[model samples]
Target: MTKIIMRLQFSKTCAFSIVAFLFLFSVKAQDKPEIKIGGALRFNYNLSSWKDGQKKRGGDFGYDMFRVNAKGAYKGIQLNAEYRYYSEGFGGGMLKQGWLGYNFNERDQIQVGLTQVPFGIQQYNSHNWFFNLTYYVGLEDDHDMGIKYMHTSNRFEYQLAFFKNAEELGFGNNSEVSPNRYSYDVAGRNKEINQFNGKFVYKFGKKSASRLGVSLQYGGLYNLDTEEVGNHSAVAAHYELNKGKWNVKAQFITAAHNPENADSEDRAVVTMAAYGAPYQVAADFNMYSLGISRNIPVKLGPVSNLQFYNDFAYMEKKAAGFTDSYMNVTGVLVSAGNVYTYFDYAAGYNHSWLGGNFVDDFAKGNPNAVWEARFNINIGYYF
Candidate 1:
């Protein structure tokens, strides 16, 4: 059912888009649409010592995904789109982002169609490929189908958005439908996701290098009626610093959800913006993260730059039964022109419900809960 729904959405809404992209190069060569073409390829070597549903250690080395980006603007109208090819599911295909924008001025703009949500710590600061726990909870690197209006000033920036599809679920890109992944899906239970989000940021320090922001989110878990049922609300605060060689970031957030109508399992349903089947975890949770990084000026062969980052993230379920989780990641990223590589070592306690081990829970009398570790490396190049 999920695949069918996504197939319908693709055929109905994006058929023309796919065709246009296939001929994008020819169109650009003949007539200048002010088009820019670029793409990226990413692959990873990952080893998971332990996680939920996994009985033993496992690892894999393979391509993660490939993406192409195109952007152009004419007058006040702008067009941006991304097409992606994944390694798994639905013949390894999907759209990552596509949007149209109208800029009223340098500081005021309106965006229509799928775009990044302006909430929490935008884009995340983790040096690792996977962001943080908030990402799994739909607070980081989350996007939606919606209309967004934004305004920016020297000291302040704000955005208002209304989204209908929560993270474009069930689109057959296995990642969005997999219950074990960090995305969300409606599971054919809800008619659509209706959400309103607002974010405000204020900068105070010189060069606006120091910044703080607050965000509010409200999502309606609509079942059948236009009068929505089920309610989810979240609030978040974040601080960031960017000066010299140091880059620091921190965030705190919490959310509560009450599915107006209970699921068959009597679980509360809340998406928050996640659009995979696994994203529907019913509980209030608090999350906080701090990441700090410093760059080292050095040239290693073609690797002309080096950056080291230490990141920590924590998530605790407000409900009584769920296990709390945390993780600390340390890595150094090397940049060689348009290519980048990350060698990361992550250690944590129950980092996530799906991504953690049960060492702490299994130890009956032992007090020191052993921490699990995963080592990974990812190399990517942009063209």
Candidate 2:
């Protein structure tokens, strides 16, 4: 009996030692440096119409897009990559984004790759869907192959970028001038642009806060003979006011120089307003609007809240002209531009998930889906 008991005790001790060794190994593994990867997928349908002679209408529905992004970080070095696939009838088939980054302390970093241009408030507010309306006239798309430097501290953040002129990539190419034979414009030939942008935000009072920002960009295009023919410049300003549940936002943007015809120039200005609290009708995400918004809560499967909004605006396009000769003949040509007035009404629903929630319902639904046949609608989703 004593011999058997001694063997049992020895086996039990060995089992405990093995289990403890595995637990410690796992803890050490968890402490090691590693890289993480994740991304999202989206699909959409869009329908849009414009007045050429009469009201022309067109629409498309398909697998709008699918995108995957991966990021790896170790110590102060970071790398990111993104790939996108779009269905038929879209501009391009495959799009890609890649970047390498380094951090200098905690408040500053430099990244080089295809990235977003840091401009208007709408450009960086990843959570706000209404920002789509504040379009800057001359800035490139959200994604461009470029290098950017970012700095952020307690109360301020700023970014600057240098980008490859997208026109050279056969992306934003101007085919009108070279319809029969291929000819490159000065801007398309050089294929480079310099951009500067910054923002200053301050928190004050008990419940109120404010922010202001400015941005500028300049680029030049050269022809085969290295002659500068097309030049472009843009500037913008943004301001925001918030107190309690009421908020106000405004922006102004101007651009000069034409991408299509190197010799031509185009310019525009935009302003917007928003008020109320989240989910509240008065606070429903609305733009350049004057109206009321209210939020109605409901118990449902996916969507838990609804917002109703109505807005009206009268807008006029600005006259175009060159900085050197604001009153030149070209400036007079700007007067021929068209002005537009719009009246808009919208109702939106927001959804919350009980468990894992990653997808944005608004972005998944058909942007042109009509609530009522009486009026047309253009909707967007954000994530």
Best by TM-score: 1
* Window of ten residues with lowest summed lDDT in model 1: 358-367
Cα RMSD for predicted model 1: 7.5
Estimated TM-score for each candidate: 0.78, 0.53
Model 1 lDDT vs. the true structure? 0.67
| Residue-by-residue lDDT tens digits, candidate 1, 12-68 | 564465334334423322243577989999998777666433334357788877889
Q: After superposition, which runs of candidate 1 have C-alpha atoms over 4 Å from their true positions? A: 1-32, 51-59, 89-91, 167-192, 224-228, 268-282, 352-370
- Per-residue lDDT of 95 in model 2: 40
- For residue 144, give model 2's deviation from the true position in Å: 3.0
Residue 203 shift from truth in candidate 2, angstroms: 5.1
**How well does candidate 2 score on lDDT at residue 176?**
16
| Number of backbone collisions per candidate | 6, 7
